[model samples]
Target chain A: MNERQRARRPGGRSARVAAEVHQAVTDLISERGYGNFTVGDVAARAGVADSSIYRRWGNLETLLSDVALTRLNAQSPMPDTGTLAGDLRTYAAQVACEITGPDGLLLVRLAVALSTNGQQGLQARDELRDERTRQLQSMLDRARERGEQAPDALGVLDHILAPMYIRVLFGIGPLTPDYVDGLVDRLL
Target chain B: MNERQRARRPGGRSARVAAEVHQAVTDLISERGYGNFTVGDVAARAGVADSSIYRRWGNLETLLSDVALTRLNAQSPMPDTGTLAGDLRTYAAQVACEITGPDGLLLVRLAVALSTNGQQGLQARDELRDERTRQLQSMLDRARERGEQAPDALGVLDHILAPMYIRVLFGIGPLTPDYVDGLVDRLL
Candidate 1:
């Protein structure tokens, strides 16, 4: 292999294995809950050998952290709809889709639960959260640039974002499409 | 026995047992997680008779629902500190304390998981959530009566309340005293 190709080969294979194992971890947690399994169980489920998991991770908590962080870090690309209401509606709809569904909802709760176990556990989660905030801020700034008097990030999240999450997390109420549109209208 | 005295006795004893079992469920779930246990395990941990738990709750899911709803229903009296700022500061501090502890945090996630399992499970939780809304609405109304320009229930909860929960649930970022004050100030 050429020098560049040789350098890239190991990473490509390991990335595939890591992706498989990480997806396995979340799927198992969502489907089966995280209390019952062993590393061997995860290895079997991921189709990676136990020795490889050991060689790569060596620690259970580290492996779990990697899974948790990887899931949290996967931000979908935001759709640009040009108009303020349309942009927010798209954003809200996307978010609603995200924190719902059986597995999706469970994973969000699991992410929260695991992240709060300690300060160290919270650090990477915090960074991911900041990234989300930045995304929101950028969206709002674009609205402002377009002459829309958009609400501040904290305000929008508190009034608009948090309610949706609370509803999903607790089954406390509904988060219908009309509701999303109304929030965007009010905020705009 | 007199009617009043006779009416109260069974309830008093049963009430105590119910509390014990409910506490036991949360404690066990927090300590050992929600899987790999039975009514007997909860009973053993609670030091109550297994027959009592079975007699009262009927099935494991019912017992789980009762615990989830009970915690949701147990809202502390919100302090009226004569101004919106003081009132919210007190409120926010209490919430931060409630959702941050090991058991408190676990119970929030447990509430979400159990509530979403079926329609019957969500009913009691939905009621409790409404009561919380009413409580916040009442607080807002009183603020209006006192001529403080407070946001309505929907606004307060959506913008003001949800952020606190978001922070607690995901370890997204810090929910410090200063942060709470900022949220309250922004909302006001």
Candidate 2:
């Protein structure tokens, strides 16, 4: 390999390990629910040493926070449909997929479970919320610049994201297309 | 003591035991979070025998369900304020108080944590949800009968209750009077 490829090797390997560890966490949460598994269990599942996990994440809560925040950041980019309604519908639909996918509810549960543990968990929760709010604000700003009326960030959160998250949290019902779009339509 | 007083003694004792046990569960959840404690922990905290708790509730999940459902049933009666908006505002405000009160988030966390364990857990989650939906339906029905325009039961759930629950779940913000009233106003 060239010098460039050689320089990239360490990061590439580190990325692979992180991906494996995250998958292990997702799997364990799906099978066992939050707070049931530990760092050792995650390491065993991911084929890594316990020290690797602790060294990387400090503890299980930190590791869980990393997994959740990483996933949140990795979610689909902000939709920029011509109109605010189109943008919201697309945005809502994307979120609906994330929360309903194979590991969706598990991560959502992890975030909720983490929020009540202590100061660190609370900080993680706040970080997740701030990231989401920032993303939503960007889209809202774009709409405002385009001269279309845009709802406030919290309004989008309360009307669109809150309903969807609550539904998943309680396993109330499916986040159908009509239901997702209906939230945006009502907000508008 | 009179015969009636003597007859009520056993029932009163039974009620007292149940209350203490429920409070123990709530306290443990707040202190330790779900799945971190057990039946023995609750019994010790409640000053009751483990056998008594097992005999009455069958298991921890059932006991948690009892605490949540009982609290849900014990909330204020449906508001009849001569208008749909008034009733909704009153109802939302009551829920905001319930969820933000001392043991409110703990019970909600219990309900959420219970929902993921197994079939029994799923049933407990469903029952908690159904009870809330039934109560909302009653209010909506009253509004309809009085010829006032009322949002559908699910609409209220999606718009009002969902937002409040989500907020508490994440410790997002306080449910101020204006915010509570704003949810009702938006629904109307």
Candidate 3:
């Protein structure tokens, strides 16, 4: 490996620690649900000291927010199908899969629980929404450039994203392929 | 007073205890969020013995479910405007108010947190959904009786209720009257 690459190794100790801690948080949320565990519990599960966790994340909420934001950004890259309908359908379906996965509902519940917390929690919620909105705006802007009629970013959020989120949040029903496509159809 | 009438007074001891316990749960959820408080905390706040609460609700989740269900049922007796469009708009507006009210978001977050707990938590989630569906069904059935083109109850849930819920849960934006009406208009 080149000297510069060696200095910035991807699998460094810090990266390994972060991965372990995140997995610990995810497992705890799945097994016990949100608000039922502590930072020490996470430390124990990850085989790290509580002091190390506190030094890095400073608090439980920050750690939880990091775990959620990291997973969300990593899950679905925005779709670019060269057409608005195709992009929307693909995007919605990917989201359905992400939220229905093993860690999906647990992470979602964590985000919701954090948003109701305090000022810090509010900031985390805003950051997550802004990230999702930014991704959607990029897709819509591309459609506009190609002379396609694209809906507003907020419209997509209300009609497409909101329904899926509410369904997963309340266990309302399954996000079938047809249902995901239907949301995109209705939005268009 | 008549013997039976006196015996079944509205302000009897049982009713008073139930109201106090419900109020206490609401206050705790508002201050601490779900899963942060326990049955003993609720009992202490309600000024009732722990045994009393345990005897009535069986557990913390059940007590929380009771609080949410009672509040939901008590709010906004489903609107019955003559036409489908009118009924939908009115009903949406009422729900907008209910969910944005003091105890609204707290109760919603509680239901969500409970849903991820276990089998008992799943039951609480199902009961909440069933109650909402039952309410929507009555309105749609009335619309059909009047020969109006009524969408299914689930349609109203997806198009109207889900958007408002997601907005509140994530602190996305305000649920203005124009926005609420737009959802109903789109659904119709």
Top-DockQ structure, candidate number: 3
Interface RMSD of each: 2.1, 1.9, 1.8
How many steric overlaps are in each model, in order? 4, 0, 0
DockQ (C-alpha based) per candidate is 0.53, 0.52, 0.57
Q: Top model by TM-score, which number?
A: 3
Model 2 agreement with the true structure over B1-188: per-residue lDDT tens digits? 88546535765877788889999987887678787899999999999999989888888888888887787767856787887888888888888998887666655576567765788787777877787778878888988999888788888878998888878877778899999998888778
Per DockQ, what order, best first?
Answer: 3, 1, 2
Docking class of 2: medium
TM-score of 2: 0.83
Candidate 3's residue-wise lDDT over B108-188, tens digit each? 577667866678787877777788789889989998898888899878877888888878877766899989999998888
- lDDT score at residue A38, model 2, on the 0-100 scale: 86
Error of 2 at B60 (Å): 3.3
Give the chain B TM-score for each candidate.
0.74, 0.81, 0.85
Segments in model 1 whose C-alpha atoms lie over 4 Å from true places: A1-15, A51-75, A81-86, A116-124, A130-156, A185-188, B1-7, B10-12, B15-19, B57-75, B80-89, B101-104, B134-152
What's the residue-level lDDT of A25 in candidate 3?
Answer: 93
